[model samples]
Target: MTVLLTGLPSAGKTSLATAARAALLAAGHRVEVLDGDVVRRELWPELGLSPEDRERNLTRIGSVALLLARNGIITIVAAIAPYAHSRAALRAAHAGVPFAEVHVATPVEVCRRRDVKGLYARQARGEITGLTGVDAVYEEPLTPDLRIDTTLEDVGESAARLVDFILHGPVLSSPHGGRECSGRF
Candidate 1:
């Protein structure tokens, strides 16, 4: 299974993904977390967050995700993935795999409040450029497999819902219950 956790910066995407990854591992599942920030810097240093650059990065990540998913490893990808086209391309690339797209639907205000890195503050002060959900774009997924609002749910419960969905399929009472995934591993 390849789970793509997408949202704006500080949207709890990494926190939620980390929690879910832990639960999956404790449940005897092979799991790994591919954080976009860390992976890009170490693995794809030449790549960037520009539209074309992002698509290229996402493609590389998607390939890795497909490879792991086929080998029965649950790959958790926590990325802003701010472009809809990039996400669509990833999904299309892994057509047959157990792909779960989870949107950490925390609003920008909430994310700003939780910005431990001061990214929002930097952006506000004109110290940074191309910040997603700010100067740059962050296209939300139209029909994500799961939508979790961190503002309304704690990290543990959010992770539990994700675990339940992956293990037993989408539960009726999802965190936000906006849309249901067709199937999952």
Candidate 2:
């Protein structure tokens, strides 16, 4: 299964992914988190934040998630994925696979306040531009499997909801087995 968590920066996508990964692992389920910042920094340092580049980044991440998911790993993806078309493309690519789109619907104002990485501060200082949900664009999901606002729900509660969805949600059985896949994370 691949769970794609999308939202503005500092909207708690990574926190939710980490909390859910811990619980899922505690339940003896194989899980992996593909965080967008880490992936971009480590794998695609040359990529800029242009729309095309962002789409390309998302495509690459989706490919990796699909590869791991096909092998029975529950892959949790935390990415801004600002473009609706890009996210839709990923979903289309995952046809017949267990895929869930989670929208971290935390408002941009709240995210700016959280600003875990000082992105908002940098933008405010004119050190950066085109920040998603600010100067750039973040096309909200038309219909997502789940929608969460971090300001309303804490990490533990959000993670519980995600874990429940993974375990009990309607997911197509993999070739490897049923809900309990038999492979790596």
Candidate 3:
């Protein structure tokens, strides 16, 4: 199974992925999280931050996720993946594999407020350019398998809902108020 968790820099994508990975591990499933930061640093350190570079990075990560899925491992990808075409292509390429997308739909304003890396600040200061959802385009997913809003729910609940979807199917608003489970959020 390959779970693609997409969101902006501070949208809690990595945090959600981490929590989901823990859930899978606790359930005795073999899972790995390929966070954008860790993948950039360890796998494709040479890749720049341009749109083209971001596409290339996502392509590489998608390949890795497919490989892990082929080996019967659940791979969780926490990446910005700001383009819809790239995500669509990746999902289309994985035939017969369990490929799911969970968009962490945190608003840009909320993301800016949660910017632990100070990326939004740097972009505002003109120290950076092509920031997704800012100067560059994000091309938000129109129909993701699930969508979680960090501004509405915390990381743990988001992950639990995601893991539930991965293990079963959509929960359709569990008693825990997972509107995300209904694929409406």
lDDT values for all models = 0.80, 0.84, 0.82
* lDDT per residue as tens, model 3, 1-185: 88888888888888888888999999999999999878988988999988888989999998999999989999999999999999887887677777877788888998888887899999999999888899999988888878787776667777888888888875322212223642211
**TM-score of decoy 2:** 0.91
Q: Write candidate 2's Cα lDDT for 7-104 as tens digits.
A: 89998899999999999999999999999989999998888899999999999999999999999999999999999889888988887778888888
Candidate with maximal lDDT: 2
Clashes of each: 0, 0, 0
Model 1, 1-185: lDDT tens per residue? 88888988998878878888999998899998888888889998999778888778778888888899889898989988989878877877776677877888878888788886899999889899998897888998877878777776588888888788778775322223245322111
Q: Which stretches of candidate 3 lie over 4 Å from their true place?
A: 170-185
Candidate 2 Cα outliers beyond 4 Å, as residue runs? 172-185
Clashing pairs in 2: none
Question: Candidate 2, 110: how far from true, in Å?
Answer: 0.7
Model 1: worst 10 consecutive residues (lDDT sum): 176-185
